[model samples]
Target: MSEIVAVDAEPLDLPLSEPFEIALGTRREASNVLVTVETADGTRGHGEGSPLPPVTGETRTAALETVRAATELLEGEPVEEYRRLTALVRDAFPGMVSATFALETAVLDTYCREREIPLSALFGGPPTTVETDLTVPILPPAEAGERAATAVERGYNRLKLKLGTDVSTDVERVAAVLDAVPNVGLKIDANQGWTPKETVRFADRLADENVRLELIEQPVPASDVTGLADVTRRVDVPIAADEAVFAPQDAVRIVHENAADIINVKPSKSGLLGAADIVSIARGADLELMIGCMLESAVGIHASAHLVAGSGAFRYVDLDGNRLLASDVVPTDDGPGHEIGGPGHGVTPDR
Candidate 1:
């Protein structure tokens, strides 16, 4: 029996120099849930989860409390296998999904380190680097235009723009971005802030703008699966389900209902393992997949990137969390450091 070790959770404030705004919310500060699990052998592993109110109904305070609850169960539980470790926590804290994920990732990291096996090899395939789409926050039309130009200059070929606060404002913002960055591929995320009618109308407008809208994510609320399917049928741009596809069962429904053309997978909302299952389910249906990240550190970004690289299902990726941060801990290695690299999960924060 592996003796239950130490579990600790703390809060950190990572400031984003630029304000990130979308229809669902806005933020200048990023709150991180940092978790560490230690084994009897004195080996310690670190994992991170960002409490995103827009996606998961978890705040920093709540996440910490849940972390505390989860850590209590680590004292003597076996950590040799991911499933056994995950089951121990799930049975204890039945519904605190993000907290469970935070604890699980830390435990998994420790287990992988013990076996000296890279996380990418354990789960998916060999580690491969991927290109990420840079996100452009909602701003005034002129500022959005300038930001778009700046992103293109910085070597980003794909862009994601925040939309759905206002129809006219969203349109003008997209127009400004397109006019400024002519060859860049564009995608918009409404964060489920529009009505079905509004989503349909805006999608038509985007198609008319000659912008080559890659995919519009969660135009309607998460619960409105019917409305989402309607928008998918009405729009020329493919619809991506973000808020709507959180659980494994949600993936099955979307495929059955024809609600989306692409699914955006974020581990914090669905947990690392749960998100992987969702990707497999989507692949079974022949749906395109995009791996996305919240405003997190390279630690969290690297975990998701490992899964993306292993699965070979990612068509578009948005692992640009490092660029949004004030600093990165890991130095540039021969691998895809900015996109993804290193051993298991490749997350070495600049501590």
Candidate 2:
């Protein structure tokens, strides 16, 4: 095994297929950062960061700056020590977040390629395939219903609708989707757009409509844990904590307070190692796990898919971020997931 020589990062603008909106904001394009790790033996591996500033509280400039400083700390480190290297990145740049894992993913990719094993093997699991749920951003009810139908036409049975603007309008929007396509697995994410009362009211409305939702995600504000618990206990539908659980400590708190029934693990919120911690905490507390994405490119999506596929712990998956991109830095199948059979992440950047 050779020593790591250089770490490089650059911001890449990947255009979206269309405007993607949620309660937090809208994204016409993905603000992604790519990281490249080079070893002394001429091995190169790549990783990507897709930060939703509104959700993860990380900006493109901050991620790039973190990578620059990280390069100084990582150069000359042994590539075989990839796990320790990733934890070092987390310790040095705790605020960098998603970028921390981007570097770690690159290092792990290099290590896996050197060993000629897929990332699933690194996580101690055989290669497996995972299904993903498509998304419909905030839109009018009729339009939302049409989008749901189109997704079903494309062979996806699960759909997540981004809502939270108005309760009545939201109810109508979901009802419209049901009217258009009734038997699909329907999940709504409010992105912290509603109050606890509103969430309960909306759930009751959906119940009256005889809608059996797979789950409701982060309807109330992230800070409102008491309210989140209230809504979770009051509603018949299970509630998943997205923004509410950013770190393992947050997951522990949610467990102690009985705030949520499921925890959403968005890689962009915490890096690979941090994600593992959160997963362990969730499992210990008997909480279900959901793997989500933040509208990243194929590079980022590949890493998350490999992690989820390797672990086989998540009950629900929403890794359709790469599918939202018109193009990506990494080459991959024109779909939402990865076939975790090849070495490392089995990904290479076009650039």
Candidate 3:
């Protein structure tokens, strides 16, 4: 039996090629925590977690401390007892979702590597290439259009625009991008920055202006599910819930209330196990699934991509976090892109 011999985690800060602006804030760098688990048989498994203070209420310092504490609880355990080990880690760090994700991923990676199998193979799905949408950060209308055009030129057909600053200005930004790349599929993420009324107003204005939106995500605040339902009722565009749903219970409530047409699943926000549960709940409710990320490194993004490919549940993929990074832990054949091969999330950290 394979046994976990050691656990290690470290803080990783990678500079972004350009400032990533969104409704929440602007980030010039990606701050992530990398976790690794080593087995007695000399196999190593890697994982990554990024703590978004605004979204998960976890800062780097807190994440580091929580990860260290959780790893201490996992050392010397048999790799086969992953469920019990993960349950112990979750119980120890109840609110540290990112930390939990890092630990759980390491465990799973180690297990899969020991078996000489890909992570997707465990789910009985053949690994396949997944196309992802590049995000256009909130910018001046013209600048947004230029960026959109550039993304389309680079073989990305789908674009996600960050909105939610102001209704009129948001419309202008969308209009500018559409004017530049007329045929590109478009989706907008408000990041829970708009009120229900404001969300409806934006949708109406976009419709009036003849803008075709693939979807509008998290228009209203996360705490206001009723408000989300209100906006959903008013908008013809599909509404996806990101901040509003973090756990399976949240997924259940969103479906029960019919608050959203889709659920955005982030493994960092919910651990791999939790994400799987959320996927099951979403499929059961006949809700569309989207796999997203939180400004993570190639490690986290690649792991998330495997989840997206393995489940075959997600209709949308927003794994562009690595595109913002100046350097990547997992080097690609091409510079940086959404590609995972080999086994166990594919690549090893250069360090």
Tell me each candidate's RMSD, in Å, in order.
2.2, 1.4, 1.3
Reference-based lDDT, each prediction: 0.79, 0.85, 0.86
TM match of model 1 to true structure: 0.93
Worst 10 residues of 1 by lDDT: 332-341
Q: Tens digit of lDDT per residue, candidate 3, span 1-351?
A: 578889888998889878988899999998889899999999999888888888988988898899887766877899878789888998888778888888888888888788777777755576677678999999999999999998888888999999989999999999999999999999999998899989988999988888899999998889999999888888999999999887888999999999999999988888777888999999999999998998887678877877877888889889888877777776653222466764777768898
Of the pair 1 and 3, which is ahead by TM-score?
3
Runs in model 1 lying further than 4 Å from the true structure: 1-4, 329-339
The parts of candidate 3 lying over 4 Å away from their true place are 333-337
Output the number of the lDDT-best candidate.
3
Q: Write the per-residue lDDT of candidate 1 for residues 53-123, one digit (tens) a residue.
A: 66777888988998897766686666786677777776676556667777877877777766666666756
Report the candidate with higher lDDT, 1 versus 2: 2
> What is the Å distance of residue 143 in model 2 from its true position?
0.6
What would you estimate as the lDDT of candidate 1?
A: 0.79
| Cα TM-score per model | 0.93, 0.96, 0.97
Question: What C-alpha lDDT, on a 0 to 100 scale, does residue 42 get in candidate 3?
Answer: 92
Candidate 2: clashing residue pairs, number: 0
